[model samples]
Target: MPALQTINVSKSYGNFKALDKVSIEVGKQSIFGLLGPNGAGKTTLLRIINMISVMDEGKVLLNGKPVKQSDIRNIGYLPEERGLYKKMKVGEQAIYLARLKGLGKQEAIKGLKEWFEKFDITSWWNKKVEELSKGMQQKIQFIATVLHQPDLLIFDEPFSGFDPINVNLLKDEILKLREKGATIIFSTHNMASVEELCDHIALIDNSKTILSGEINEVKQRFKDNVFEVSYRSLSPLSLPAGHFEQVETQQQNGVFVSKIRLLNGNKPNDLLQQL
Candidate 1:
């Protein structure tokens, strides 16, 4: 069964429609990518799921049951906008947020410590949020979000404001969370990250769902049947006919590289035999 499912969900604000009959199913323990351009209603859909806003139409289910107010405890959300209290100490803020997620004081502190240690942020515990760098604050926010170990995790623009190394570190942690049985909904403009991490994706455009499917299947559907072949050759050679309809050859790093687009299902072996 899906970890989360939305059926014909829609949301509107005044005369503006933010989401139009958006439906999606997120499988258990999977990384589901929510992708779209700016002003495409991605944030509106996320707000509905987080219960920050009400949907104008349709319903949402979590683990096959209708979503309820109490179900908020089962979700960990990191919004695109950072919400840290600048005057508060990192540790205190983290604990408070975790408590809001239904964790006991003892559990929240213990879990926060473990996560801080894991992320190498233990030294930042007593520091005021304003004293930390943006990336450091983001780390604290991330710690707060996951400290309660909710079953579902939602991250919006998770890599924003982080350097490349930290971005990769966060990506690794996200994968780890999935392996540990958390269902993740990742909303971002980073198509490269989606290509790397998403098992499935749904793309929203103009407040409507324009695309949705398993990542590999979607990529395959978009494939142009192009292939690149590299081989070692000392001299230039005439190309074989059956290898491709059009072959572009180049010399790179002492090797002959060729990009081939097959014609009429021609096999690579047929070209190799002629060479």
Candidate 2:
């Protein structure tokens, strides 16, 4: 059974529709990229999954059963906006949030300590959240989100406010979480991150799901079959007229490299045979 599933979910405010029959299935231990442009209902769908808001129609399922209010305890969410309490001390706020997610005081402290040490932020434990930099606070909130070992994790634009090094750090940790049996719904506009991290993707546009499937399959579906081939020969090879349309050609190190697209709808194998 999929770890999470939404069937025909929809939401609206006043006369403006926010979501329209958006559906997605997230397999266990897999990374599912929720991709969309601004105001495309990504946040609304996430709110429905997080139970922060009720859907106007359809149901959200966990492990093949309809999600119950009680099931929310097993889910973790880190929204795009900052959620940390600014006046609270870093360690204190993290422990408080982790406890709210069902961790005990002792367990929360232990888990949070380990994460802080790993991130080399142990020195900031006693510092107030208002005193930390934006990137520092983001790390603290991330630790709180994952400390309780939730079954499903939702990260909305989690890469905000981080340097490239920290971005790589967070990316590695996300992959590790999936390897350890957590299903993740990652919402972001970063196409490079999507290509690097996601096994599958669902693209929403105009408040509706316009694409959903395995990542490579989706890319292939959207691809125009263009090919570039390099050959070492005595002279430059010419493509047969009416068979292939040449886009560009160049010579490098006595090798002829040709870029071509299908003009006559010739199969890729036919082009290779022609070469």
Candidate 3:
């Protein structure tokens, strides 16, 4: 069974429909990207999965069993919005959150210390959350989210407020989480990150799923039948009109290179034979 499945789950806020019968299956130990533009119901779905908000209709299943309220302890969620107690010390708050996730006080302390060291934030242990920079606080939230070692991990734009170096570090950690048998539901607007990290993706638009599948399969299915060719034709390159549609043309090192889209469901072999 898939690690997570949403069965036509839906939600609406009065006149505004946030999610419309959205269903998704996330395989275990894989990165499932939830992508959409603003107001595409991505956040609403995440809230439902995290059990922070109830779905108006449908249900969520974890490992083929109906997800119960108690299942929240099995999932760790880092939302897009940052929330922290400004007056509380960084380490103290992290341990508090970890304990809320079912860790003992001592266990939470030990785990938070290890994570603080890994994130190079050990120096900020006693500092109040309000004293840390936005990026530093975000790092703290991230550490708190995963410290419980939950079965499912959900990150909504987890890379926010991070530099390129820190982003790479977090990405590596996310992949490591997958290796350790965690199911990750990753939501992001960065298409490059999706390409780099996601094994499968579902694109939601207008409160509905518009596209979904394995990353490479989706790309291949959506690609135009265009091929770039640089051939030495004895005469100036000319093709029968309607046989090949030139999408782009350029001269590279005195060689004529043209990008042509095969016409009428024709394959590259047909174009090569004519060339």
Candidate 4:
């Protein structure tokens, strides 16, 4: 059974309909991406799943059973907006959040120490949250989110404040979580990260799921049959107009690279023969 499933989830706030019949299935221990442009209701769908907001029409299931309030214990959510108390010490706040997620005092402390040490932020323990940079605070938020070790995790724009090095660090950790049998719902606008981390994805636009599937299948479905060719040509290149349409051409390092799209049922072999 899928670790989580949302069926025809719809939600509205006043006159604005935030979601419309959005449905998705996340396999067990898989990294599922919730993708969409801003105002596309991706966050709304996530909120519904996390039970921070209720859906007007739809069902949320965990392991094929209807979700309940108690099931909140099974999820860890890191919102796009950071919410640490600015005046609270980093370690204290993290412990509080972890305890809220059902971790015991000692467990939270041990987990926080391990995570802080791993992230190289052990010295920031007693510092107020406001003393840290955005990226530093982001790391703290991430540790608190996962310290409870919930089976399912929802991270909204988890890489927002990190530098490239930290980005890869967190990416590696996320992959490690999946390897350890946790299902993750990752929401982000970074297509590169989606390609690297997500096993399946759903694209929401204007309050509806416009596309969804395994990543490679979605790529194949939208492929335009364009091919890039790189050759060392002595004379000006020529192609039969009916067989191929040249989209772009550029010279790099003594090689001519051109992007060509097959036309009128012509194949690459047909283009090769013409060349």
Candidate 5:
């Protein structure tokens, strides 16, 4: 069964339609990427799933059942906009958020301690949120989000403030979460991250899902029959006419590199046979 499903969900604000029959299914224990341009209703859809906003039409299902208020306990959400209280100490704030998700005081503390140590932020426990850099604060927020070990995690622009090393750390943790049997809905504008982390993807444009599928299948669907061949050859390379159109050719380190487009439904093997 799917971990979560939004069935033709729609949301509107006055004359503005933020989501128009937006629908997506997230597989269990997998990372799903929610991608779109600014103002494309990606956040609106996530809000509906989190019950922060109501949908005008359609329903949300978790584990093949209709979502209930109690189902919120099964989800951990990190919004695009940070929500840490600047005046509150990092550990104090994280524990409070964990409590809100139904973790007891002791359990919350224990969990937060482990996460903080993992992120190398144990020293920031007593420090006020305002004292940390944006990247540091982001780490604290991430720790709080996963402290309860919810079955489903929703992260919107989770890597926004991190440097390269921190970004990779977050990526590793996200993959680890999936391995630990958590389903993740990862929303970001970064296509590179999507390529690296997502098992499935849905692209929303203008409040509608314009594309969606398993990552590799989606990539194959949009392929343009372009191929690049690199080989070592002493003589100038030649190809059969009509099998391919050579777009470019170059020689580097005594190797010929060529980019070609298949013609008339010809396969790469056909081109190779000619060469």
Candidate 6:
């Protein structure tokens, strides 16, 4: 059974539909990508899952059962907008949030220290939230979110405010969480990250899903039958076949590299034999 499932879920504000009969299943230990342009209902769906908003139509299931109000304890959420008490010390705020998520005082402190140490922000514990940089605040937020080790995690634009190195660090942590039996629903506009981290994805457009499937399958479905090749050449020359549609070609360090999108019955091996 899927760890989380939404069946024909819909949400609206007045006459404007925010989500239109959306259905999706997030498997256990899987990284599912919820992708879309702005105002495509990704946030609406996430809000419904987080219980921040009510769904006007359809049901959401957790572990094959109707989602219970109390079941939210099994989930952790990090919204696109960061929310932390500016005046509160990082450690204090983290402990408070963890307790709110049902962690005991000792457990919260232990987890917070471990996470802060792992992120190399141990010295920032006594500092006020405002004193920390945006990325540091993000790390604190992430630590608080996962300290309880919920079975399902929802991260909306998690890479925001992070540098490339920190972005990669968070990605590694996300993968580690998945490996340790957590299911993650990642909502992001970063298509490159989607290509790298998603096992399954649902693309939303205009409050509806435009595409949904396994990542590899979806990429294959969108493939243009293209191939890229590099070869040594005695002289600079181009292939003279109408069937061989060369999208791009370049010569670098005396080697010819070209990208070709096949049109008719043309094959890369045929082109290679000719070469």
Q: Best candidate, TM-score-wise?
A: 4
Q: Which residue segments of model 3 deviate by more than 4 Å?
A: 227-240, 248-259, 264-275
Q: Sort all candidates by lDDT, best to worst.
A: 5, 4, 2, 3, 6, 1
Arrange candidates by TM-score, highest first: which order? 4, 6, 5, 3, 2, 1
lDDT of 3 by residue, 155-192 (tens): 99888788989899898888898899999988877767
Cα RMSD, each candidate = 3.1, 3.2, 3.0, 2.1, 2.8, 2.5
User: Which parts of model 1 are misplaced by more than 4 Å?
Assistant: 227-263, 267-275
Worst 10 residues of 1 by lDDT: 237-246
- Residue-by-residue lDDT tens digits, candidate 2, 183-235: 99999877676578899999998889999999999998998778998889988
Q: Any runs in candidate 5 off by more than 4 Å, and if so which?
A: 228-241, 246-259, 272-275
Model 6 per-residue lDDT tens digits across residues 144-212: 878899999999988888899998999899889989999999998777865699999999989988898
Model 6 lDDT, residue 130, Cα: 92
Which structure is stronger by lDDT: 5 or 6? 5
lDDT of each: 0.87, 0.89, 0.89, 0.90, 0.90, 0.88
lDDT string for model 1 (1-275, tens) is 99999989999899999999999899999999999987899888988998999999998999999899999998999999877899999999999998888899999999988999898889989999999999999988888777788899999988889999998998899889889999999998777865789999999998899889999998878877667777888865566566564467899777987777766766767656655
Q: Which residue pairs in candidate 5 have backbone atoms (N, alpha carbon, C) closer than 3 angstroms, thus clashing? A: none
Name model 2 segments beyond 4 Å from true: 227-241, 246-259, 264-275
Which residue pairs of candidate 1 clash? none
Give, for candidate 4, the lowest lDDT window spanning 10 residues.
234-243
Question: Which stretches in model 4 have alpha-carbon errors above 4 Å?
Answer: 230-236, 249-257, 264-275
- C-alpha-based local distance difference test score of model 4: 0.90
